[model samples]
Target: MSLPRIAIDAMGGDEGVRVMVEGAALARRRHDQFQFLLVGDETQIKSALESHPNMRGASEILHCEDVVGGDEQPSKALRRAKTTSMGLAVNAVKQGKAGAAVSAGNTGALMAMSKIALRTMPGIDRPALAAVMPTLEDEDVIMLDLGANTEADARNLVQFAIMGAAYSRILLGRKPRVRLLNIGTEENKGFDRLRDAAADLQAAKGLDMQFDGYVESDKINRGEVDVVVTDGFSGNIALKAIEGTARFVTDLLRSAFTSSLRSKIGFLVSRPATELLKHHLDPNNHNGAVFLGLNGVVVKSHGSANAAGVANAVEVAARLLEDDITNRIAKDLAELGEARLRETNGGAASEGTGK
Candidate 1:
């Protein structure tokens, strides 16, 4: 068996090189089948590796000098941040030096660089970022186009569903139930584009998966869908809403507990349950996001990710590479032919021609 190669952007996250290097070491310890290529400034990476010398020879460093800030325009950085760590890590995957790429850099910059370097699969219109989130049902739900295609058309939405479904199958080991995000479950509740995509998804062929129609935002945590698809603009908004709500509720609970002696006693009694909730909702536990529909496996981690979170993200990338996810996605997209059919049928037909 060939050992998996994962390229890590060593200087991308807020925690800096030490945490990223330690994360790679942690992942290597767990999965001995992977050899990581740590990309960053050579001097810093070497210094950090010396402090934590466990993965001593299992990892290697690829040096690059510049760094792109989160606020930099993605397109501009892709063209300009040529020697940056993010570009170097992604370039490794493009150059075949690595089986997959993992990064904790600026989300937009990472997406832009991956798209530019790896491009999209033959039948894919746009690449979507698919992230798994913990649900109230003790299982994770896959959410896609999380700021990838901000203004996607109906056809793009359908493509996101297909890509997300394939990912869910490979990673989650099941045929995911597909759902479209809408204002209501009613067939005519959303905008024209969403309604059209919902219909197209219903008529999609060659996928041995389940389509569960429209899912309202309220249904996200209720286990209503295994895979929820939407354009990046709406998906990003929904993601932020969930994050903010989780933090707000946690803070509210803490304030309530400290309000009075009686509440403090009650909180002490329920400390275990509160801790469980915190553990379950922490974004670090679900740190990886796959850039679906790309030619190569690219997993993006949160900017604020810690060492443990980076380790988990690396595991996700390694698993995707091992499962031959890129090949599977190519086969699925080629077999479906929906995207091509839409283009053939006058480019804007009311009904999808899954020809």
Candidate 2:
């Protein structure tokens, strides 16, 4: 099959058209088969593309006169869906002109526009944002609901698990060990909804995942579980906390290394090891946060991300398109439906037989 073409919001991100276009060019180098639909002002996009000679023939520019501001409310942004650069890029996905859409624009605006344009997939109540995080283990871990829905019911939590597990399968190439994030690891711990979700996941029959009970926030990066599922409220807070902690440790190390002459020499001696650590913890390496459960793939790049980070986000979109993530999600939902049907039928039969 031919590689899918990705739609990019050229006017999005802090660096404007330059970084987005340069990122596209970088991504093209990694995946030569992929093409790009650059959506933004024609003159600016043309100027940006001029800097990357090789990207000239690989991209098609879609002129967009308007743009959604980073601070614009989702309600107001939705009204500009037909004209904004972000909106046009997402619309390309809805119209099937592009396989996926990537934007570094306003997060709220992007989410609102994507849902309105592409709609949620069947059996998914609400879409969730899933991102890969570097872990102590050899492989990165996938976490979900990073600010999509503020609150999730038991059913929503269950759906998040299924979607997360499917994503893990794509990234890890195996059935992921899924776990519900909570205050404690004990089954009896956490709120009613979390415990209830855990029970349902444990009783689930057909999913190709191992339910590993509850996992605390402290153990998330240990790589014990492949997928960590949680409501958006908690997930968003946890994500920010982890990011802050990573920054803190890195900053502390820098301070320690520059404290004195001896430390400076020590830093030079350990430069190789520190470089590896920096690479591992770099946010650019894990820049993409996918909105799973949407009918079409939509990757949200960090607003302040540089060309390398944007390229990483684009690569994520390409992977999802190639792997057909939506189809995999549908298949898993079917399994869950069948399992529920069987349970219902069995329960009715037992009641009728007075067992």
- Which regions of candidate 1 are displaced past 4 Å? 338-355
> Candidate 1, residues 1-355: lDDT per residue as tens digits?
4656889988888887888888888887777767889888999999889966676677888888788877888988888656898898888998999988888888899988999899998888899999998887756899988898888888898888888888888756888899989889998798999989887777665565688888888778887688998888999999999999999999999999999999999999999999999998888889999998888989998889888899999988887887887788777777567544755465456355542
Each candidate structure's TM-score, on Cα atoms with residue i matched to residue i, is: 0.92, 0.98
Decoy 1 TM-score against native: 0.92
Candidate 1 least-lDDT 10 residues:
346-355
Q: Pull out the clashing pairs in model 1.
A: none
Cα-based lDDT at residue 105, candidate 2 = 94
- The lDDT per prediction is 0.85, 0.94
List pairs with backbone clashes in candidate 2: none
What is the per-residue lDDT of model 2 for residues 216-310, given as tens digits with 9 covering 90 to 100?
99988998999999999999999999999999999999999999999999999999999998999999999999999999999999999999999
Candidate 2 Cα deviation (angstroms), residue 201: 1.1
